[model samples]
Target: MSVLKPKIMMLIGCLMTSSAMATEVEPYNKANAQQLKQSIYERTATATSAIERYQLAKSEAWLSYADHEYSEGGFTSAGKEAYIQANQLLEPSNVNLVTQIISPSQVMRRDLWWQIEYLKQRGALDVEPQALANAEVMLVWAAAEYCELGWRHAREHFISAERELQKVIYALPEEKPFLNWSETETPELSALNGKGCHGVNPDLWPLKPKTPVEPEVIDADVANVVVENVVHFAVDRAVLNTEGKRVLEQIANILAEYPDMNITLKGYTDIRASVAYNIALSQRRIDSVRDYLLEKGVNSSRITAEAKGKLEPQDDQKIEMAHAKSRRVVVYFNDAETNSITVQPQWRDLQIER
Candidate 1:
C-alpha cells in the first residue's frame, strides 16, 4: 500500500507540471488575427435598432483596440479577453443591458457602472441617445484600455467619455428644476480621484427625480435661457473663474440643444475702474465668454455679446456688494422665430441691480 501511494503522488505531480499555467507566448498570427476580426465582424453585423446599434458600437470599439494590441504588441491573451467582452454587447440582446453593461474581468468598468445605472434611473438614454451612446461605448473602451496589459493608453477615451456624459447630465429634458442644477446654478466640473469612471465624483451627478422628465419644459424659460446672475467677475478682472466656466458650459449645452434660442451676453465692470478701462475690461470679459461659447460649439451667429461698461448704482449702501454685482455679464435669451423675449421691457433691457 505504501509503494502504491508513492506512485500515485508521482503521477499527480507529473499532471500538475504539464498543465501548470497558460504559456506566456501567444498563439497569435495573421491567420488568427483575420479569424478573430471576422468573428467579431459577424457577431455584431445585424444591429439595426438603437439599443442594438449602441451595443454593436461598443463591440466594434473593443475589437479595434484588440486588433491594435495584436498588431502592435503581440498581446493575444488580453486581446482575446477584450474580444470576449466586446461580443457580450451583441449577444443575449442589449435590451437586458439597458441599466448596466456587464463586464466580468475588467473591474475598472465597474467603477463607471454607477454612472450608467444612474442615467438609466433618470431614463436619459432615450432623451440623449447619441450623446449617451457615445459615452457608454467610450466608457467600455476606457475600461478595456486601462486594464488590458496594464497599459495607460486609455486617457483620451476616458476624457471623451466624461465630456459626453457631461452633456447628458446637463442636457436631458426636464420639467422640474434639474435637481437645482438648471434653476439654481451650474455645478462645478467634477474631478477624477482615481475612483469612479475616469475618477468622476458620482455624488456630483445630478440627483434624478422619481418622475420622468418633461420634454416640453426642456428649457422651461426658452426665451430667457440665461435668466440667472450667472457670470459675475471679480473686482476689475474680466477673466472667467472656475465658476464662470461652469456656468458657461451649462449655457453652451443649452444653446447647443436649442439653436433657435439666440443668446445675448452683456459684459459690465465696477465703478472704480475708469470708463475707458471698464469698457475694455468688459470687452475682454464678454470676449472671453464669447470665445468660450464658440469653443463649445455654439454658432457665432447665435450669440450677440457686447460690453455694457459699468452700471452706476443709485446708493452707497453695501457699495462693495454693489460693485461686485456691477462687474457681471447679463445673459438673456430671445426666440429667433419671433425676434422677441417674454421678459418685461425693464428686465429685457438689463435692469441695473442696485
Candidate 2:
C-alpha cells in the first residue's frame, strides 16, 4: 500500500480566518496604496546608488503586492502589513523613519522586530532585501494575525518569520551600526530599545517548544483512521488545570497541523453524583476544553462536543486514586471515512489541580 500524506481526508477544509472577505480594507486601500507609492517615488527620485535603486524597486513591489492583497477578500491585515514593509524598506536618508514615522508603542512581535530592525540598521536590507523583506512581512503578519484572530492563526506566521529572519541573520555578517561602530553584537542580550511593551512573558509564550503528540499511523490503506487524545480534569470542577490546559494545547496543535481532521471532545465524569448533574458537569468540562481550543484558533465549525457522565467512565473505581481518571475529555480526531489507517496520541495521565 502506498503511504499517503498526513492529510485528514475527513476533516474540514482549512480556511484562512482573517484573510478572506476582508472588505474592511477596501475603504483604506486607495489611501494606503497612494501613501506607499508616494514614499516609494520620494526615495526613487533621490536614489542615486545602484543599491538604493534596487531597494526602491523592492519597496514598490511590496506596495504592489499590498494592493493586490487589499483588492482580494479576507486579507485586510495582510495588505496593511505589506504596506508597512514597503515603507520600512525605503529607509530614507537622514530620515528617522522607524523612530519618527512608525509608532514606538508597537507591542506585537517586538523581539523579532527588534532583531530585524537591528539588522536593517547594519546592512541586512542591502545584502539581502528579499530575505529581510520576507522576514519583516512574516513578523508583521504574525503579530497582526495574533491581534486580529489569535495564536492558532498566528503561530504559523511566527514560525515563518523566525525561519526567514534566520536566513538573513545567517547570511549577513554581524556588522556594527554606523554610529555605534565599536559596539559588539549580541542578540541574546538585546533589549526592546524603549519600545512600549516588555517582551513576551515566558509563562505565557504561545507555542513554546514542547514535546508534540506524535500520532502513530497503524496502517497505510485505511482512510477511516481517527487520532485520539485525552484531557483529564479535576474532581467535579469544570475548569481545566495546568495539566489539562497543556493537553488541550497539544490537541490544538494537532488541529493546527491537520486542518482536515475534525475534533470531537467527549466529556466524562466519574461515577459519583447523579447522572444529570454529572452530565452537566461533564458538558462544562468539555466546554472549558472547547473554549480553550477555540481561543487558540480552532474553527468552531470543526469542533463537536459530547457529555458522557459516569456511563462510559474510564474505570477509576477500583483504586482510591483512580476515581479522577474518569473525569476526562477524550479528544477524537476524525478523518473522512476513506481507506487509511488510524492514528492515536500517546497520552494517559490523571490530572489533579487544586
Q: Write the per-residue lDDT of candidate 2 for residues 1-354, one digit (tens) a residue.
A: 121123421111222112221223323468767976887788678876534654576567557656776777755645665566566556543122121111211235545655655555444645555656556545545555565567897798787766556545534433222222222332222242233322232222221121123347557565453444666767768777665677677767767877787878888887789989999999998898889999999999999988888887553223433465677788876776312425443223354322
Highest lDDT model number = 2
Model 1 regions more than 4 Å off: 1-48, 91-94, 98-105, 109-111, 130-157, 174-354
lDDT of 2 at 204: 27
TM-score on alpha carbons, each prediction: 0.39, 0.34
- Candidate 2 global lDDT: 0.56
The deviation in Å at residue 64 for candidate 1 is: 2.7
Q: Number of clashing residue pairs in every model?
A: 0, 16
Q: For candidate 1, what is the lDDT?
A: 0.53
Top candidate, metric TM-score? 1
